[model samples]
Target: MAVAVNAAVTLPSSKTSSSPSIRFSSIAPERIAFSKGVGYLKNGLVTGGKAASIRAQVATETPTKVVKESKKDDEGVVVNKFKPKNPYIGTCLLNTKITADDAPGETWHMVFSTEGEVPYREGQSIGVIADGIDKNGKPHKLRLYSIASSALGDFGNSKTVSLCVKRLVYTNEQGEIVKGVCSNFLCDLKPGAGVQITGPVGKEMLMPKDPNATIVMLATGTGIAPFRSFLWKMFFEKHDDYKFNGLAWLFLGVPTSSSLLYKEEFDKMKEKAPENFRVDYAVSREQTNENGEKMYIQTRMAQYAEELWELLKKDNTYVYMCGLKGMEKGIDDIMVSLAARDGIDWLEYKRQLKKSEQWNVEVY
Candidate 1:
């Protein structure tokens, strides 16, 4: 059962306008639907206050047990075995830093020994339960991360799984430093450490099966996790079941050159299949655009939005975007301008893309 969380938020009335804005705090982060322009409900309704006063109650408690019947996707539904309440205890095999020593943030490549039949696909995620108690003296909840390795595992032949986790640390409003519980716990694990893992969850980021489909992957920060899995499945692995000869363009953004993750692996793949695989980087701190502004993923996309608009017209072009939710608008703006140049309504075009299951997004 979820505990009720009732928050009395004050919306300050403007001197000219009749209503004020709604400020929401003390709500569960998982329940809040934050976006680029406006906040929305889980069901896709905008939460913008149309009235002077609004009363909202958020269910802040996490379900201790989750046994969903199935998770839906374009590839049909998959019934996952592992879940939060009944999790699998797996052994940590390796914990290595993927980022350079001079990087600003700490990102790691963690591998865990699969106990037995813990099966997962290319884009699914596993839930990790930290080994500690929260303020309520209860066990810490599970945190989900996209699996960074192929279903066949690291060497292309094992039952193990991997993750790309960044240590989260930030200064709070009261001038206090806080660290994320599960991230720090995973980052600090040793070779023999025991971790409670659960759920091969999430279906939105799943890959299409067409071998000739053009894949446009846009990612930033640790959002590169799932794409890493897809790359491995396409170029590195020897799975004859899925042969990919299509064009895969990856646009990744990072703060520094040292922040590039799996840099060697991507280089090797590009060398092996130069014509089929392409990877572009937007190192913000190290490079600037023609406009003298710091180059981000959006800027990199704008450089070729016209070409991308052409590709979007193809029925087989699949665009997968996973990163900070804030980038949605910038990317949208770029596409809007490019679409307008050809007298195409980008809003309706995007809708058709979604209806065709060509546009996939899994942002945080």
Candidate 2:
């Protein structure tokens, strides 16, 4: 991440350095008029008399309240309402395994009773602090999990928040079994069990307000969390303020068909809105793509590369990716050649999409 410094400075002309002169066409003429000695600069040096005049002009012209007002209009994106030092104690309402018993690992769908105390939007995450102390003699650190339910929640009420968690259990180099403290705690949770929770953090994966916009979701494993929330809002629920009339296409990758999460719910959604929803599964072990290659998300996506590229070219299309960070590289590889077909630079195009908030990513 790059930290932006807010300090303002006037650089000397290109004659002072080996670099060529660069023009900043976006800067307003009046703002840089100081270079002509009308304000602060006098022969590349700040003049006290002119500096005060420029400061007065800036103070009167700049919109000091723009940032504050923009935040106020931001559709209520909630953040850390509960902190680690003082976390919210909520009760688990339900904890049921969603994955098949014979699947590679255990994945559970748990809903916590917030009782309207902990408000959250879709695509946000909650932090869970496990009950026990760690080897360092300190309390276990909280683990963040993506919220699986919409703002209306799993019960179609605002009192609950849900999560999709995969239990982490593995053998260490010493041949000892190790389990993830927070994940195991969440997975084994029973109804009425108290859970220490914090945060409804993150804004990157928030759904766009454009109700008719096309949504392209790419997920792997439990990365399906946020997308499930989005799909529920788009298909299963009805809102007086919002209606999704456009397309939502999902590509989910998993090791086996049995590991597919929320299969029944997604199937029902597709049945209800057949024209508006489409789903593709990439089961690496059971499915193969064209040319007999193991079916992965990117490979399945490659089948519709042309159609996807066209949709991506539209202003109302949004692509969201969440899962393992390596999935990004696979997507980039798929898009590179397709973008080149139209003489476009894929990286630069993707950057513009990000700048416009059209391409959203939340991968670990």
Candidate 3:
């Protein structure tokens, strides 16, 4: 007998705008509609949306249990160890531009010296408070960024944390050049500069415990932060307790070849573990599909939809998406008909996967 469950998961609120709303149904599961943008699922609970902003609402009913259980399994996972009012003061160790000078925008890779004061996992995020007061006369709020280094840190000493940030500068309708406060502040930091840091927070994007699991990662631009942590742990570092023997396939989307983040590292990993690792890029500006269409991530993914669907059927396979909220709709468009051909409801199947902790998404 099959049991039907219907629930709604609210995402976290963001300063930017309203969070995405999610509702699950067994009878007639509607396509996930975003009030403003799409929401993200940590375990089974849909908390927030977007990669740049942290906007999650509360979970209700059975989804709440799923959140609790996921947290229980992550024993000793730190959260909010440093608050905005009393943040841990850390020093900048390195700040370098990872993108090309002529690329669409400036993206920076920065390392902060935690010195073991901040303990964080692979998929967690850290909040950064810029040193200034806002026009409202209050301190600038902390902005959360996904951790780009593994638990062992970039130097493998467990004494540092890293982040991949894109300097946000855009022109408003008034023709004024406005810069993102936190982003510009962090980007221009000198070595030894003090930083106010908060929370090694979030459990939604954590790596699976299975060493032999088939991990499929989809990321765009700076959203590759958490995936970098996972890949480093899987390929670069050696652990006595964990030895990964399964496959890790990554599908990265970017505007151009130069915009691809961590390309050299990913290429090295692919070279080192040819059998266990695979990577495909959707360089929208540089590539075109068979139909002569601009190759966005989904169009690139559609090329492997059959094979991907087959992998999705396996119990050990997990799918993780982290990037723009718009990517969700593109992925769904690819999977919907393929799932229908087999008389399966892709959304419901995805919900089941979420219930089993297999489908993890953290999109912005």
- Encode model 3's per-residue lDDT on 202-319: one tens digit a residue: 9888888878789999998888999988988888776788888999999999999878888777776777789999999999999999889998899999999999987776656788
Model 2 regions more than 4 Å off: 1-75
Best by lDDT: 3
* TM-score of candidate 3 versus the correct structure, residues matched by position: 0.81
Clashes of 1: 0
Kindly indicate the candidate among 1 and 3 with the higher lDDT: 3
Q: State every prediction's TM-score relative to the real structure.
A: 0.78, 0.80, 0.81
What TM-score would candidate 2 get against the native? 0.80
Candidate structures ordered by lDDT, highest first? 3, 2, 1
Tell me which of candidates 2 and 3 scores higher on TM-score: 3
- What would the per-residue lDDT of candidate 1 be over residues 85-185, giving only the tens digit for each residue? 88888988666666766789888777787844577887788899999899999999889898887776653334578898999999999999999999999
Query: Over the stretch 1-364, how does candidate 2's per-residue lDDT look in tens digits?
Result: 1111121324335464211122332232222211111111000011245433332332323323211121123757778999999999999866666777578998877778798888887778999999989999999888999998888766555777889899999999999999988899998887679999999788888887778778999999999999988987887666788889999999999999879988777776778789999999999999998699999899899999988987876656789999989889988999999777776777877876775567899988
Cα lDDT for residue 310, model 1?
Answer: 75
